[model samples]
Target: MIKNYIKLALKLMLRKKYYTALTLVGISFTIMIITVFASFVDQIIGANTPERNRSRMLLLDKVSIYRNGKSTDATPSVHFLQHLPKLESAETVSILKRNEFVSFLNGKTAGHVLQQTDENLWNIADFKFVEGKSYTTDDVKSGARVAVINEKTKEHFFNNEDAEGKSITIYGQAFKVIGVLKSAAAFSKLYGDVYVPYTTDMNLHTTEKAIEGTYSAIILSKSEDARKVRTELRSQMRKIGRNANGADSLKLYPFSSIEQFAKSSSSNDDEPEYGKTTIILLIVMVLFMLIPAISLINLNLSRIGERAEEIGVRKSFGATSGALVKQFIIENVIITLIGGLIGLGMSIYASKLLIQVINSFDPLFKMPTDTFIVSWPVFAFCLFSCLIFGLVSGAYPAWKMSRMNVIYALKGGNSL
Candidate 1:
């Protein structure tokens, strides 16, 4: 029976080429837009590269210092980093500061962004080394002028040769390259061309009785331990504020996922509106699909009206209304599923083309073409959308046809 339904659906679709083409185009475009949007969002939130342990990590990128009804934005300080180790829930904590890009001159000069971090950051971030090893705590404490360069930096300086123990001049100072890292995507937060110990510069450690400075802390902990970590952090902040003598109060805002980071960047609120953003996105996609679904539904109704005599004849031959409804629903679902496959193919093609175009113009972007992965979650979302589309566009037409009076239907009279 199911095979017959599919066979009949194929025949009918081929018989009405115009309607079939219109429906397929509509469904395919809608699904393609949806899939592309889903893939983009997944790329933003999904873990990659150095931050692969993002699910178990939290970022304290911004701090709020409130004084006399005014608030000032500041980065985390060495004070915060020193206290994070006391938290029982924390696996490891790290601090880093964005440094000025220094000119690297061997034969040619190139500027690269440098990040100053501690040894603990190496443990927290999974930076894949290409040549050597990360700097140690002893090196950081001793203020050694050692640096780790990324793959791009290595090529620019050494031309595919080994970079380890090579002296590179930066900001009129010579530093020895200790390591080289694999390339990281531009979207990654921890990506940098060069990494050095924070203690190499005394300016980053300049802090008075205040707790605000130019440093950001990253907390590495299990997902289950996040609540405890937050609680402990809040308690620690209160303790620091108590000694501030009514001129200062500190707050630690942690962004555990891309969504949180986006919300924080977009607004001044401490809590991210993840649920609201999710609902709004869902509504937008549904509305996007609904426009085409409504048009297809009307088309289905008109097509069913043209086949009134056929439906009437079959009904008179002991074809139950339930069987007719099932067949029509199945036929619509088949059309939608086919459209889904076509849409998936189109999305993949579009993504590749987009990557190629971007890479052609901007070599410095460093974006991976394979970043848009079609994971199981994406596949499931596509199937769910297809099912909703099938039912919305087919249900009313099938029900109306099922309830038609045999006498009127046989006489070529249309009624709803």
Candidate 2:
């Protein structure tokens, strides 16, 4: 029965060539827009390179402090770093600093985003290395000027040649590139074109403690431990993380990858708006599909009208309304699946092209790396969404038209 439904669906679709073309095009355009947007959001919130421990990790990126009525906002400081509350579930914690480094490349100035880190970062992040290895504990302890660079940095400066074991000059200091990373996801605490040891930055070696600095932290823990971690962090900070240099107030929040993106722009003084962000995304997706869904419903009704005589004949032969509804929904599903596949293919292609284009202007504006992964779960999500559109648009109209009296339908009276 299902096989017959598919054949009939295809026949009906081909019979109205223009209508099928228009419906497929509309669905493809709508799904394409949704997929592109969702893919980018996925890059920020989904598991990716370096931060593959996304669900098991929390990032502390920004801090807010108030002292003598002066408000300052920046990355967490050495003071907060030193006083960081011990998270009971923490497996490892890493401290990182980001800086813009200017280097002379082919007699022209090139800027790179650099990450300075302790050895712990390497433990939490599994950076894919194309050449050499990451810095060791000894190198960071001895303040060795060693660096790890991304492929884009390698290509920009060394013309895609071997970068490991070669010195790259930044701010009159030559740091030997120790490792070369494959393409990595950007726009995170771990994001950078070049990476080096934090000990080499002598400015951070200051004996005096401060409230704000260019330092951020990432803590790896069990997925279920996030609530406890956040709760303890708030409690511990209020008790001991303050009172530095007369700054009686300080604010910071720890977030998972998805929460981090959602709360990226919210004020640190309050709890992150996780619920609000989720609601907004749901609303946006519903609104985006609303128009396409209405069009599909109307199109289904029109198609039913054109086949009123056929429906009447089938009804007279004792065809059940349920059977007719199921058949129409199946037909709708087939059409929606085709549109979905086309949209997804276009999204994957666009993402690849965008990656190449984004690399040319990277560190200035970092694009999410390697978006639109074709995993079973992702594909299933697309399929499920397609099914929803198919059922919603086709089921009711199919049922109503299928239930029309044989006499009324045969007379070409389309009143539903």
Candidate 3:
């Protein structure tokens, strides 16, 4: 029975070649646009290479100090780091201080962003090493002028030769190159040309009895331990506020995920924003899909109207309205499934084209490679959406045609 319906659907599609082509193109393009956009967004937030442990990591980049109800924002200070309470739930704790500075190589000056961090930063944030290894906590505490450079920096300064044990002058000081790392995501917070120890920077580790300065902390823990870690961090902040002058009201926002980080960065909220953005995106996609679906429905209604005589003949031959409705619905679903497959292909091709175009315009506009993928769940959602579009656009037209008066349909006149 399904086979007969599919054969008839194919024949009818072939008979109206122009309409079928138009419908497929419209549906496929719409799906392609949505899927590609979704893929890029997923890559930006869900990619697991740079922030490999992002799911189990929490970032505290900013601190808020309230004096007479006027709030001031700054990075956490060395004092805060020194006095921070022990977190029972965190497995690893790391701190970082990043700044842009000029480095001299072969009498050429180049600006590079440098991250000053401890050995814990290496264990918490996964950085792929091309050669050598990360600096140790002993190196950090002893104020060793050792550095780790990324692949780009290594290529630019050393002609991609062995970077280990080489010395590069940063900020008028020579630092031994101890490690070379693979390139990180362009948008990653940890991205830098040079990584060195925080203790090596006298400015960051000054003996200041303040709770606000230039420092960020990373907490790594299990997914289930996130709440407990946050709670302990907040308790510590409150304790610090009680003793610090003009900082009696202090707020610490620990971002557990990219979505939460974005929200906290944009506002003071601690709740995740991705869930809200997801709902908005779904609503928008549904609205976008509706336009093409409406067009398909109108085309189906016209085509079904032309088949009124066939319906009458089938009715005369004792065909049930339910069976006719089912047949037409199946035909629509077949068309939709085919369109969905075409759309999936188009989406993948378009994403590659888009990346090429952007990169051509600017070579430095490097997006993360091998990040975009149409995962199984996304593909399944696409097929499910196709089914919904088919049913919505097909059902009313099928029901309407099936209920036509037999005698009027036979006369080939408008039944309505």
Candidate 4:
């Protein structure tokens, strides 16, 4: 019985080759677009997880003071590092200070400030060492003039040569290369190439003022409970920096929290509604699939009308409604499944073409390598979507074919 249904299904599909082709094409295009969108969203969310030791909590000044008729925001201040005792309980605390207009080897200029940090800075950020090692406690204590460069910096300056133990001039002073970092995503603010000891300025530059020149301090909690640590740190900061009314209004944020805040703040006020965008895309895809499905359903109904005598004859010969429905459903399933397989193949080819187009762009603008590569999830998702579409689209047509009245259908007076 199943074999007969499949045979009939194949004959019907072959008879309407143009319709089958159009349905498969529509499904393929929709699946391809969905796959690409999923990959892009996955890549964007995954960007925040590049470093293994990303902090759960970050310490920043919360107080905003007005001085000289100008309001000063102190939420992300460096002074919190010096006075906050809550940081001592933290798993690790790393101070980051930037020095802009710093010169490097061969008169290469940097528009951004060079970051200075202690040995703990590397541990706090999970900086992947490609060559050599991170700065040690001894190096920080001795105020050694050693630097670590990121992969981009290595490519920019040393070319193919090993950067380790090489000397690079920074701010008219020579510093030895201790390490090179692997290329990292740009989610973190520490995307700069050069890394120097936090103590490099002890002898060269000195300032007693707390807020004179400091970038920010990052504190990593031993446990995942960063909010608790942040609160404690804020309370300690309030004690250290007393306001006129002696109130503490400092804010502390976990690393992930800040990212959400940044994204929300960065969204354009006039952007289209997310629900509208999603609904529009869904409606379009459904319409693309719906037109073909409806046409196929009508085609199947017409084919049934022509074959009404056959169905009526079978019913009179004692075929049950259940058996008839099963036969018709199986036939439609076979036809739709064939179309689905074709669509799946087309989707794979289209996805490959899309990835190639993306990779042709410069690395800076291109999608991440992981995202560009099609994984098992992509194949599974495509297969499932195709199966659902095929079954649902064919169900209505099969049902209508199964519901014929034997007497009327046998009379065969243009019944549909």
User: Residue 136 deviation, candidate 2, in Å?
Assistant: 1.5
Top-lDDT candidate index: 3
Model 4 stretches astray by more than 4 angstroms: 1-49, 55-71, 75-79, 97-114, 201-208, 211-214, 241-249, 252-254, 257-416
Per-residue CA lDDT of candidate 4, range 1-416, in tens?
A: 78887887678667877855665565556556555554444333332433344535453323454444554555433443544464555787777775543444466543333678767777767567889988898998798999988776676568748999998777778889989877544334554467888778643344333333354666777776555665666566556554522323433433433333333444432122345545655676566556666666676666777677878887899988777777777766665566556655665566556755765764333322322433456556656665666666657755665577888778874354
| Candidate 2, residue 364: how far the Cα is off, in Å | 5.6
Over 1-416, each residue of candidate 3 has an lDDT whose tens digit, in order, gives 89999999999889989988987897788778767776655555554556778767787877778887788887888667656678777888888888877655678656677888888988887789998999997998899999999887787689899999998877778899999998775546677788999888868646567878888888887564566777777787777775764676777766766656357435436555666667767788888789888988898888766888888898899889999999889999988888888998888888777766776775543443433456565677777888888898899899988998988888875484
What TM-scores do the predictions have? 0.80, 0.89, 0.77, 0.57
In the order shown, the candidates' Cα RMSDs to the true structure are: 4.1, 3.0, 4.4, 7.7
Ranking by lDDT: 3, 1, 2, 4
- Weakest 10 consecutive residues, lDDT, candidate 3? 363-372
Worst 10 residues of 4 by lDDT: 362-371
Top-TM-score candidate index = 2
lDDT of candidate 1 over 1-416, digit per residue (tens): 99999999999889988978888999998888888777666655666667778877787877777898788877767655655436677888888877656463455655576788888989988888989999999998898999998887788778879999997766666679999988665456676778888887667556834466777887887564455677777777777774643546767777677546457445546666666677777788889889989998898988876878988998999889998888889999999888878887787877766667877786544455654455567768887898889988888888888888888889887764
Model 2 lDDT tens row, 71-149: 7877877556857767776787888888887776677666788888888888998788998999998998899999999
How well does candidate 3 score on lDDT at residue 204? 60
Superior candidate under lDDT, 1 versus 2: 1
How close to the true structure is residue 402 of candidate 3, measured as C-alpha lDDT?
92
- Candidate 2 lowest-lDDT run of ten: 363-372
Prediction 3 global C-alpha lDDT:
0.78
